[model samples]
Structures are given as C-alpha cells and as structure tokens.
Target chain A: MIKIETCLTPEILSLHQLEGKIAVVTDVLRATSCMVAGLNAGVNSVIPVIKVEEALEYQKKGFITAGERGGVKVEEFTIGNSPFEHMQEEYHGKDICMTTTNGTVAITEAKKTAKEVIIGALLNVGTVAEYLKEQNQDIVIICAGWKGNPSLEDTLFAGALIHRLQDQAELTDDASFMALAQYQQANGKVADVIQNYASHAKRLSGLKAKSDLSFCAQEDYCSILPILNGEAITIKKN
Target chain B: MIKIETCLTPEILSLHQLEGKIAVVTDVLRATSCMVAGLNAGVNSVIPVIKVEEALEYQKKGFITAGERGGVKVEEFTIGNSPFEHMQEEYHGKDICMTTTNGTVAITEAKKTAKEVIIGALLNVGTVAEYLKEQNQDIVIICAGWKGNPSLEDTLFAGALIHRLQDQAELTDDASFMALAQYQQANGKVADVIQNYASHAKRLSGLKAKSDLSFCAQEDYCSILPILNGEAITIKKN
Candidate 1:
C-alpha cells in the first residue's frame, strides 16, 4: 500500500518518518516554480544552495547565480527570483545555481532522509504527480512554507497534487486531507483564493512582485521534472 | 498592534517566534477540552505533566491523575481522557494532574517561551477569545497536533477562534488566515467537517471514543478559562 504524508513546513521536516520515501519539495510562490521553469527552458541543471556565499562561490566558477531573500534579489547575483527570468533566452543551455529564503532550506533538509527528492510547484504538478504515480514507494510532499510557518500557496499546491493522486495512493494524514479540502474550497478559483489569502503573495505584492505571483499560480505551466541529483536539480530524462 | 499567529503543530512551534507573546494551547480532541471542563466544574487547579510517571508522582501527592497515551487510558491513572469524566461531581473542588499524547507536551513547550499560556478548545472558545481581547499582547495559538503532524480538528478549532477574532486582531501570518478560511468553509457544520477529515477522530472511533467526540465538538459548552500558573494549569479567577 502506498501512503502519502505532507510535511506542511520545513520546520517540521525532522518529525516526519521519511526513510525510503520519495520527497516532493514544493515552494509555489516561487522558488520551485523558478527551478521547474529553468529545467523546462533547457537549462543544463540547477544547483540549490542554502547560503548566499555558496551561490556566490558557484558564480565565481562561471555558473549563473539566481536567488532572493525577503522577496528581493540577492546582491551580486545574475538574476532575481522571478520565474519569467528563468524563461529568458540568456539562461538557456547553461547551468544555474540558485537559492531562496525557504525552498532551498527545505530541499537541503529533505535530501538528508528521502530516497529521492524532486522539485514540485503548481507549474509542474502534473509532471510530478505522473512521476510519483509510477513509483511504488511512499511519498512525502514537503511544503517550503514562508520562513518556517505554513504558507497558503504551498499548501494549496500540495492539495492540488493530492487531489490528483488520492485515488492512486492513500491520503494517510490530516495535513493531506486539510490541504485537499483547502484546494477543493478554492478549486475553480485558484488565483483569486491565493491572491487574497496567501501571506507570501501579499508580501511580494508589497515588494512589487505581482508578475511572479501570477506566473507561479499557473497550473501545469511547465512539464519538466526537476529531480535532485547529488546537490543539483537536473531534468529527469525519462 | 496585536498580532495573532497560529502554529498548526507543536513540531513547528520553534518557527513561530513566540517569545513575549501569549500562547493559547489547544488539544481539541480531549486534553485541553478536559482541562477546560475541569476548570468549569469548579476544580481548584489542573497540573499538566509531560510524562506518565510525573502524573503518577502527582497522584501520590493526592492529586487526581488523568491522561491517555496512544488514545488509551494510561495504567494506574484515575481516569481516561473523557471530558465528561472531568464534568463529574467528584472532581469538583479538587486539583487534577493531567497528561496526554500531544496536548501537555505542547503546553510544556509553550511555557518555556510564552509570556502566558492558556488552554483553548471549542468548549471555551468565547472565553479564551474574550481574555485575549483584554490583553495588550501578541497571541500564538499552538495546536497540539497528533505526534508531530498537523491535525484537522485542532486547525479547525484554531480557525473557529480566528473567525471570531479576525476583526479585532491582525491575523499576522499565513497559518492564521488558512485556518480561518477552513473555519469559514465549515462555518455552520464543524462537527460534520471534523468527523470526515480529522485523523485523530477516526483513530478514536476505532477505539470507541464516540461520546468524547460529541462532547469535544460543543462550542462554548464551558466558560472556564484554563491558564498556566507556573507549571500547573488553573482556573483564571477573572
């Protein structure tokens, strides 16, 4: 029997019994979204770094550095956190090293225990779900919530994924059920619900990142499965 | 400015930055509900212990011992986790020492950081909200989620409390807003929603704790405010 559990935030990642499970790490507004876009746009691979200095070290090695902290572009980096930037032709056919406030932290943590780790977002929900459907192992959806607290967008994205896979797998925990219920509550109107309720969206709006909000909310906008390979996220070439 | 944040599980309690804030600890299935019921029944004080052995020690000191582990009555305890037992005439005018699988652990953790800690449940939502309104401090609703994961019933109860306090307090973070939205989705039918989604309720049903479920769902059934006095939980005289 396949069981699916959700770690609603990275803060609780340690409490999850994740041995032998596949971890789908999500940061919908917008770190994982950016990575998915980069992989789909034909970037060679995306390396996730937890520190700005680590990203800078990769930049010194001639890799394109991209990330943000507190919703602003990091200093001395090649690009900001906007997923649309990953869609730029300049980054095509190149390796990108990235970090963000929450998503990288979650990915780094999940990698410690999960047998396999994949980046997930609303943009790649279909791709991630399809990949997980074929796996016979248990799944843990890790939501990269805002600064250690649960975020509406990530939970909604997890719910969207759960809604797709519920019939195929056991929704074994309350967080999964809660996320699916929240997703159902906002099923037909995802953008509107997220705009009004997501704290990170409101924070980004305050920082003039409205375009990133709209980009991150587009379901199945990207088809690439960005799976963690060693320390870098690379496209899973099936 | 009074800000209200909801920690959906004790596992993420550290991420909440709860220092100097008032912590409203909730374990809606039974622990906090029992504590609230005990206070309403005119119990002089209730002590929350983290271990079964500590509860036993308190029992040796003539305090009525009460608690459960894994949803079963602990061996050598005065009673199991039924709130109705707390409502019994025998417990009136006496101090009760209590512990449980999740709630007391959360209360013990919150006491380490919170300026004040109070028990919250559907049975005393109005009383808890009224008390918070009178205080000029930030509030953190710490949900004693089941075994390091978020529980639906606790989050829904937090949502119900948020629904009541949203107009008066700044719902400072995403968890608070997410919870309030959930409460709104089940506005007039909390019991039905919880019955269908809460994992702990289903677990209890397997253990034949149906009466406990019905009693825990009653909103404002008791008006007593359970607040922490050093290490013991006691009725707030005000």
Candidate 2:
C-alpha cells in the first residue's frame, strides 16, 4: 500500500525522507491558495522565492512581485499574498514572483528533497488528491505552519486531503492520524472551526483578512494543481 | 494571563522560547510514565542520561539502570522501560539511571534551555497541572515523539495536560489548541482511544506490553511530579 505521511511544519520537514515522495504543500491561510487561484485565473506561472530580496530582484526582471511578511503586504511589492490579488484581471496571463513568511520557505525546502512538490489548499484539495492517485507514489503532505509551529488550518487541510484519499493510502504516521482526527472533528465546517480556533486565523482576523480566510477555506474553488516545475509553480495538466 | 504552548514533538522544541517557560516533557508509552510510577512508588530520584553508555556508567556507580531502544529493553541495563519494573520491591528507595530512544533526548535538550523541566504523563497529569498552576509561569508541554517524529499518545497527553489547565492559561499556539481538540474528542476514554489509535501503543502491544498501555493511561495514578534538579529528577514536594 502507498503510505501517507504529514510534516506538521517546515521545521520538521528535514526529518522526513522526501526523496521518493510527492509532497503536497499547504499554507491555507494564504500562500498556496494564492497559487491555485492565480493559476486558475490564467497567470502563466507563480515563481516562489525564499527571500523578499529575491522576489524584488525578480520584479526588476519584469515579473510582478507579490509578497507578505506576517500577513501584511510588503511595501515595495506590486501585490500582497492573497488569492484575490492573484485572481485580479490585470494579473491574468502575467507571471508572479512571490515570497511569504512561511509558504515560500516550505516550498523551497521541499523542492530540495521531494520527488515532486505541488501546492495544496482547500481551493484545490480534490485536484491534488486526483494528481497523487495518478502518480501512485508515497505521499507526504507538508504544512507550512506559522513560523515553524503547527497551525490548525494547514493541519485541517492535510486531513481533508488524506480524507479524500480514503483508504487508497495507508496513514503510517501519527501526524496523519492526528490531522484526520482534526478534520473529522471539524465535521465539514472547517472554515467556521478554523476562524474560531486557529491562532493564525485570529491573527489574520485582527489584520482584517477574514475574507481571505473564507476564500481559502472554499473547497474546490479551482481545479488547478500548482506543481513546482523548475522554480516556477505552474498548473499540473492532468 | 499565563500562556500554554505545545511542541508536538521534540524536533520542533527549539522553535519554542523555553527560557522562562516550565517545560513539561512527556513520553506516555513508557519513559516518563515509568518515572512518575517509580517516583510515586518510592524510587529516590531518576537521573536521565542521553545514552545507553551513560546509563551503563551509572550502573558502575551502583545506581539501578533502566533503558530501552525502539520499544525493547537495552540488554546492559538492570531493567527495561516499563512502569512495572520501576515499581519492583528491589527498585524501591534506589536511584534509577535511565535512558531511552526519545524521552531521554527530550529531557536532556529541555534541561538546557527551559527554566524548569518536569516529567509529564497520563499517570501524573493532574499533579503536573497543579504544579504548573502553582508555579504561575508559561508552560511548554514537549512531547517526546518517536525518533523526532510526532506520536499520537504524546500529543494526547499534551492535550490532556492543556485540558486540565482549561482557561487558567491562554492557549497561545496552534499546537496547544490541536492537543485540546484531540483530548476533548477522546472524551474520557483516553486509554481505550490510545490503545486503539496510537502507533506507539501498537508497537508496545507487539512487544507484549499491552498492560503498560492501560497502566500508563490511568490518570493521576500517582501524585508524584518528578522534576529536573540539575541532572537528577526528584519528586517536587508541594
């Protein structure tokens, strides 16, 4: 049986042997959600850079830079890390160079070891599961948790993705079991549950980003599967 | 208000600011549970060393040595990592020099940075909560996860500990929130839940340590709060 595992945060990503696994990376509060929304909206590709300076450098090369630090948009960037920004008509057909507090770091780190890295969020959770089924590889869902700490929403997303697998993969790790348990407890009201329970959700609410929370929480908002191809996250054409 | 945080596994323990926090380290399958049971049954103090070689050195100093690796006893030690062995008549009033795969590493690492390090397990969870309440300091419950990976039983113990704190301490991190959710879902059947769900419990069951699961799952089995004072874990006298 193919195995399903979870890295609750990027800090523990190194502990997982990612060489033979397809990593489904999620930052449900925004980053990966932005990628899915952008790709679905006709953006050519989303380039993820670890440093804000790297994204700025990409801006100098004509790519529209989008970035955030601690949920607020970087002052020098063309846009912030939000799905709405990614879905805007002006950004359609344009390429984005992006960086964020947690998501970009997780993406770059995962690229180092995972056989293939794909962006995952509630927005495209179903598509991610479908892609993984086609790949038929052992899977590890990597959650870009809040600053190396586990976050509720990302874990909840992991559970949702695993739930989609539904006995096709064996959950060999406790983190997978824990995620599934959280998803089960959420009882399909993940958005309300996260808004009320996640520390990061409260952080975003305080920053007036409640709308982003709901948008990111929407299941199958897009069928786009954003897989990291070279340095750019482009749609995975099934 | 005091804060409650959780390191779901020791691998992410460094991400936490442990300087002023009371670190409650738990390895519920055996190690910490053994300490709580042993101390409660009258072992003088438990000295946690990080290596089997160090445990052997302590045996040379006439201390009773107990250790395990991958759920089995280390051959050179006087006893293995079960609560029953620690409660034996010969071990009463004797100091134990112990080391295990994950628990000892967590205990030693926690001691380096945390202002205070205390052993926590289902066996003495209530006492741990009481001690933390009296101390009135921020608490970081560190789960000694299996081989630096998160484990179900340890996370459940973390939730159980946080549940006991229950509004007394602010649940500041997502890990703490996740733990509380798991504990609530377990719904007072933690022993059965763990035996049914925890991977570590299954491993122990394969080793014929099923009784240890039920024994360790017993809440408040002892009021002993074994705390690190230098390298030795002595009972904290209220």
Which one is best on lDDT?
2
User: For candidate 2, what is the interface RMSD?
Assistant: 0.9
Give lDDT per model, in order: 0.88, 0.89
lDDT of 2 by residue, A1-238 (tens): 6799999998878788899889889999889998888889889999999898998899999999998998899999999987888999998899999999999999999999889999999999998888888778999999999998899999999999989896788888889999998998888899888888899878875444888888888887778788899999998775
Candidate 1 local lDDT, A17-127, one digit each (tens):
788999999999889999998788878889998999999999999999999998889989999889888879988899999999999999999999899998999998988
Candidate 1 lDDT for residue B154: 94
True contacts kept of 1: 0.78
Q: Candidate 2 on B1-238: residue-level lDDT in tens?
A: 6798999888887788999889999999889999999998889999999888888889999999997988889998899998999999888899999999999899999999899999999999998988888888998899999988888899999999988888688998999989988988888998988888788876775444888788998888878888999989999886
> Which candidate tops TM-score?
2
- Give native contacts recovered, as a fraction, per prediction: 0.78, 0.78
**For each candidate, what TM-score against the reference?**
0.94, 0.96
Using alpha carbons, what is the TM-score of model 2? 0.96
Range of the 10 consecutive residues with the lowest summed lDDT in candidate 1 chain B:
B200-209
Model 2, runs deviating above 4 Å: A205-208, B205-207
What does DockQ give for each predicted structure? Answer: 0.73, 0.80
List, residue by residue over B24-99, the lDDT tens digit for candidate 1: 9999998999988878887778899999999999999999999999988898999888988887898889989998
